[model samples]
Target: MPPAIREGSLVFPKVPVLQAAGPLGLCQMVETSILNILGYATLVATNAARHRLAAGWKKKLFEFGARRAQGPDGALTASRYAYLGGFDGTSNVQAAYRHEIPLAGTMAHAFVSSFASFESLKPATSLLGPSFPNAVLAARDSVFKLWHEKNFSQMAKEGELAAFTAYAMTFPDGFLALVDTYNTLSSGIPNFLAVALALFQEGHTPQGIRIDSGDLAYLSREARQQFKECEEAFNFPFSALHIVVSNDLNEAAISALNDEGHEADVFGIGTNVVTCQSQPALGMVYKLVELEGKPCMKLSEDVEKTSLPTAKAAYRLYNKAGIPAIDLIQSASMPPPVCGRQLFCKDLYDDKKRCFFIPKAVEELLVLLIKDGKLLQPLESIEVCRRRCITQLQHFRADHLRLHCPTEYKPTAYATAEVFPHCRHFPEWRKRENCAKQTRKCVHQTLTRNRGEEITYTSQATTNALPFKRIEGSAVACCCRSGETCEPPATRIPTTSERCAGNQTQKPGLAVPHRAMCAACECGQCMPHSRISSVRRGISKNAGTPYPRVRACRSECRNSATMTIGSLIRHAHRRR
Candidate 1:
């Protein structure tokens, strides 16, 4: 699947995203660990991508959540994945060291408050060791020249200026001061500029300043305006200085800043990105879908909880504009869908809803990542993954990626009735079991009378009592009881009630109700009892049916060959 695939996009459900076809014990042992790792990694990466989208493509985004993360390990993971999701850098030093991610940060309030006055800068030394005193005098003279104010010492807080001066002496080329330690407009900006101008005189360029409190948008604008004033007055490049913002910022906050028209060049995000406060958990589960070469299914009264059966393949269908239109899942054995050929697609849970379209291009989503317990290729670098994510997002339609009233990207997961006709009836049979108490009895009686060839009847209340329809006009004969007539295949189904009545058994000169007679015709049941039992056993084991109907069928039925009781009882559990 594409890295930027949005939420609600069906990511090949019923198909294995990571298949472990090995010894059963080995597969079972690794399930929990794999789920745990993939779940959180995917969650943080997606959250970071959303933040990137909200912050826009041009702005720099840094991960500043190490202290706020769950633990040291979580902080490392968040930093790595956040960078992979398009963040520019991280404040976590260990993450930057380990992953080679660019490091970004600024001074704290403690650093500013620790400085008392000009005397506090006495211990600070610059790169110009012997000429440090002369450099400081030159820097102060340059600041005075820029502002043309002789009383520059009284213009801002002495401690703040001392702090900025000390930091500049330490990292003159990479100094990014935290300006909100005292007063943003009144003292912080002015003190930062005085030290920045001093750094300029010492032949080193200052990086930027950060605002950690107050109205960020307004403060950034005012700070930028102040920098521009100094740039015009002194004929320096002060207007180009960066304006970084921090203090519990999030995606919405960045967007709001954009809306309010601010000069913020970088965002230092922390708790929200690392902790995933908007959605704390990613609901990814590990389930066995195939074992011993047989398909497995988990049925649930809640349709969404029902697992898809079999090993399958997923294909993303793109329209002519190179935008993805639909994601289609099919059994692994089926050939890949071809472009320019009309294909039928059905909704995962809805039987009545369907569509047909010819794709301009089709991309097989599943790839062989590992073979013979060895990786097929080297893992992608964080930068490569980041680029892939950003590029993939751009291919999607704008409306589908929007935050509000976004159009849903349609996905289809269908078990073609042509290949698995019995599977097509599973949903209908499950619904029948829920709607009628007598469905099990009906199935038992039909199985007994028909000798397990096929089901001969179904309740009219559970299904539409339409006349029997053929599967794509195929010549295959329907399974019927002895002396019962089988209608010839028809291209169009006859809707007349007489056709359903004629297919049913009736007494001479006796009147029979239309619905009751319609129930007697074996319209859609063609798969043998053995095939149905295979499907039933797979579903019954995991579906959590409340009743003992399955156990009863196993004990009571003398002819094990003619079992049909498992069909209706497979999904008898209540909705969860």
Candidate 2:
């Protein structure tokens, strides 16, 4: 069964995010592997979501964590899940291509710093000076001279510009400069602008500047101020330039930057995005909730560690305002919530706590993703999952979405009479008070009735006890015919010769079960009551009338030779 869908629904810990159902051991082998995969995937996705939320709706968040990821495969997993958690794009090319996610990246710092000096451009340096004069060749000599004159930091800045000029020559259409090699504000930005202005004048628009070091919040503000000043002075569109920040940024750091008034347009998240540094594992668990038709439970000293025992379904209850108000959990076999009916909810751990809501809308969150070991639906697209994350966030109130001190969301058990009967704990709550009263009354009656009896209690009392010794003797023996004495006129075991002769005289169709013979009769035809109890094991209740009626024996014996085939078979076995 597919569960209802609801946006901004808090379903985890309220109900299982994934459920497996089958016979007692049908899915036993796959539980651990399933939980591990789900646990890691959920953790990364949640981490990505926090970053997206922290970045705000307008700003873009990109996954640049391939190299920092656990492995190449892990990198792919991160990129896919990050997109689902609302990231705009990813740096992993394979992930982008496979998942249809937008691919994003530009020149790295090493790419920009690769060029040393323009003089090293060879014998063609002077020949090409006029053609690329202002952007590359014109400043090469002066920049190299400063590099030889000033500190190593200044030399590094010159190299950055030298490389940027080369890259501009290569790809003039998109010119995003990495401006933090030596110093973001000092030499990097200045050299970048000098080359960028030359590009702008030549009818090319510079894309943006990237900051890879320093206090990102402070650097972004400084870079934006410079860009604004240049736009006014140089009379070009500098304001349109994007300020990309790609330091050690995580969700918390992003939120902090936002709070402190950063001017960043895009965030390139790496280690923290893919690794989920703060909470690396989701700790998801797969437990056996049911065995065949019976409910199963695992006890733990920590109540939170305990698992809910039985098949279950989950629901989302919306308030009158159409905002999700509570998550309701129910037995899978229980009837679903009906429209216009008041649905009662109980706390998962607390029996006394209860609440009721007449929902404006009801939604089930689980769908039959798999059926009988086969997938029931195609996997949702990355775009669809990403949009779903955003849509779900929008349905919740702002208080719950806060990055710090967020409002907590909890799930409640569905507890109407029908729902309650299905819940083992809910019904017990109703019976507790009555049970206590009845127990007290019974205790009082027991004490009152036994008040005068001299009672002795001992550990060995049961072991030393006798079976009705005070009243026991022998049950009075009754005659099978006259109800007088059980003693017969002659009591003697028949010899083998006589036994064989008796067997020979039995009815032809008789074939007795080996152990069903009676112990009380030597004549081969005794009442069923005279047979040992084990003789009746093979006898079905409908196995015809018990010991079919027999004609009176010649000597009025308890066992007669003219008994029915069943009786004769049972009797021959007795003689054997």
Candidate 3:
């Protein structure tokens, strides 16, 4: 998925984003390391993109979080990903050099405090007087002329002025100062105007000023007003100077500033971008979904915990306006969705919520990154990725990207009875059985096993007893007693005898003996006789297999729990 895309818009409940098709040992060895690298890199990149959305596209955003990052490597990674996520530049010199990102920053407060008084300017003045005396003298005279009528010189600090003057003299064309060391409006802005007017007189343009503390919105506006006054009074273009603000800014803070109407042209972000203060960790896990050409699934009592079975493909459907309407997941072998065609889409977890969509465009999101353990193409550069992020965001609706009460970008899976006939629409509670049936269908369709081969169909069973097998040419249906409806596998509760049988662990890689009926011994370990008798009659008539003797167990089945025969088989396979 694109980094600019919102979360929850493209969910893969049972879908796999990364697939490993090599030896099991090699796949297991790389799982943890792969997940760790992908997780944090994605988290910080997404966080930076959110900041960019809040700051707006016209405003400049710089990553100033090297000091707040985890370490040197963390800092480098944050810088690279942040720029790729839409930031314009970074303050980390090393990151800018290594990644070829533009570098942007301003003087710190310490630089302002280093100058004590006018005496401190002697060294800089002696060094620079011969080179540019006329420009310095003109700027000082213009500032003194304003003090006579407005009396602004008394309130301004001489040390800060000396610092600004020295800095302007050293780098007149790129002089951007930090203006909140003493007083932003009363002293800092006034002193900066003096040096700015001097630089203007010398035919050099000063960059701007940065406000690091206090109410940024109000300060920026006031500073802009001061610049306007100087521009009109001195007859220079001081009003055009940029106003950069930085002080623990994040998405929320930037959005608030936008609401309050700030005069800021650039935003310097730090802690929130690098540390991911709002959400420190993204929950990305590694799980096996296929092994030896068989579909694998993880089942849990919580429906959300159940993983989707087998290899799948994801597609993004777009409406007429080119805005993404739905993300569709289907069997990898299924043909891709086509434009101008109405397709049936159902909610992955909710059967009641269904819709028919005719998309203007269909995009296949999963592409082949590696083939035969080698790269299929050269890796994309950071510049290309950053441009892609920006371009894609332009197509989404404004409401979806807003900070508050954003409209939801709905996601629907493309699994219908038409595609997978056995997968009839079912409620959330019955999804386990539906998923099991779908898994069997996926395996059959993908593997294409030969005739006479048996495929095990396991429902929620109490013990590791004989698993129901589907013969190549016959159907395996559940049998119920006369006038008694067969229960759905998910809701069926294990009987006391069945639970007791389940407690006895079976040997690894060995199938437990089939029991047509539990032994009627002193322990009273058995299922209801009616159901057992019905199943025995059904299996014997359909498969023509004789029933085996029942196994007697000593323990009592006092605990009742919900479990699937598929889960039992998985456990036994793991033990092997």
Candidate 4:
């Protein structure tokens, strides 16, 4: 039976269904996020030692020992890698002044402490700003969480919660406020949500909220519920608020959060990220893997011990359509991809091309944090980054993909799978035999699976952990380039005739998306929960007019197909 509609014809529960599958650009924040975590590979053993190839066992062990020789001194500086990568924004004026990198950070519980006794409040705020003007001043949830009337008055005076939003308006790029510091998913959630409803709260939303303690899944769910609750309580709709993640955040943990419908803006990759609790140091080393004259390579039984015999900088190649095609690592000798995907694709899989070049298209630092401790440029306020991110996501199209189906940074090809540094090494005697066996295994595995689409890049390092050295005189491979451009494979979708069997005069009724959309329909666009204003003062089509009774999506035709990037990708996959 057709599921019966409830409430005599309102949009009903389509909201939850829609939110389940919202926009794609909303998920990918590669440049901003990666920069926040890449700095710490400067020294020493990592939490997890790379066990690359079993064959080069002895040499691999020796190489690992060599790495330890850099010893305890480097460890001190190595520990600061995360900070160098961008996480140490604890009002770290020094780090900011040093690396010429932005010391990105938010406010702490101390922000709330400033409001102590109102007498010292003004000096307190001034001191707070001067104390850490470089850091993005994120306020904590010190204003609310009160059950008393006077507390509410204090909230009004301090506008602590409101101040976060106000601070965003004036200093949009200001460090974010700790939105959920006080019962993040509950009381604090509603107040921030109250700001957005009906209108396209499309501009900058909340600073950032810390999801302190709770079943993140349930907390995210409750967060949505509370927004809905406020909209209902005040009689309107609302968008989502900025949420920062604190407790436990890693790749897997991040996946869980986004999976549970939580879209945290920034992740304070503390404890775990800094500790490298799982896998220790990247074991990155700068060595003369190749010297001026001949082809050099390390022969080892341990795959990780094998190092690519060259030094090269990585490059990003884009298709004609400007989509990221592949990642290329090339030495000074290698000619840049002049025309086509072949050279780019080859460079993408080379062992010497392990390091990824920073992507230019994605949102990145518009201003450097420091230059010789003399603040080279003002750090972009957090709001600037956030808005740039949103705009990039919207305009950049497929540049944003799911984590699982990430826009791959295909490495350079032709680079041998010789281990560089993270793994182990083996004798040439064992390596030849092992290589034969591995090649056999690879071929057998490929044949057995017959999946026809195994993503095989000519191996970079045979194993995960191996000794690494920057190649100073590595003979550069100046391969000839195929003079043609890579193209964004045109995905021809179904024609209207193929989709509907006949030409229609017009699209009638609500867009019956190929799959139902999660965003609320606003002026024909789907606005996620974070983009709408609350019923009180958000944008409205029926502005100044009396509230119109909510009605069913007034479409008579039961058409099932509407256009969307996701559906098109799915359809393309089905055809394949």
lDDT of each structure?
0.65, 0.62, 0.65, 0.33
Please tell me which predicted candidate would have the highest TM-score against the true structure. Answer: 1
> How much is the lDDT of residue 446 in candidate 4?
9
lDDT of model number 1: 0.65
Worst 10 residues of 4 by lDDT: 12-21
Q: Candidate 3's C-alpha lDDT?
A: 0.65
Across 384-440, the per-residue lDDT of candidate 1 in tens digits comes to 777777776777887876655778665676455433322333222211112223222
TM-score of each: 0.72, 0.68, 0.70, 0.35
Q: Give the C-alpha miss distance for residue 458 in model 3, angstroms.
A: 30
**Candidate 4's C-alpha lDDT?**
0.33
Report the C-alpha lDDT of model 4 over 370-424, residue by residue, as the tens digit: 3333544455543343243333233333433333454543344323234222212
Per-residue alpha-carbon lDDT of candidate 3 for residues 506-527, written as tens digits (9 for 90 to 100): 2334333222111111122123
What stretches of model 3 exceed 4 Å from their correct place?
A: 1-16, 122-134, 147-150, 416-576
Displacement of residue 407 (Cα, Å) in model 3 is 2.5
Q: Looking at model 1, which ten-residue stretch has the lowest summed lDDT?
A: 442-451
Model 1 / residue 254 / CA error / Å:
2.2
TM-score of 2: 0.68
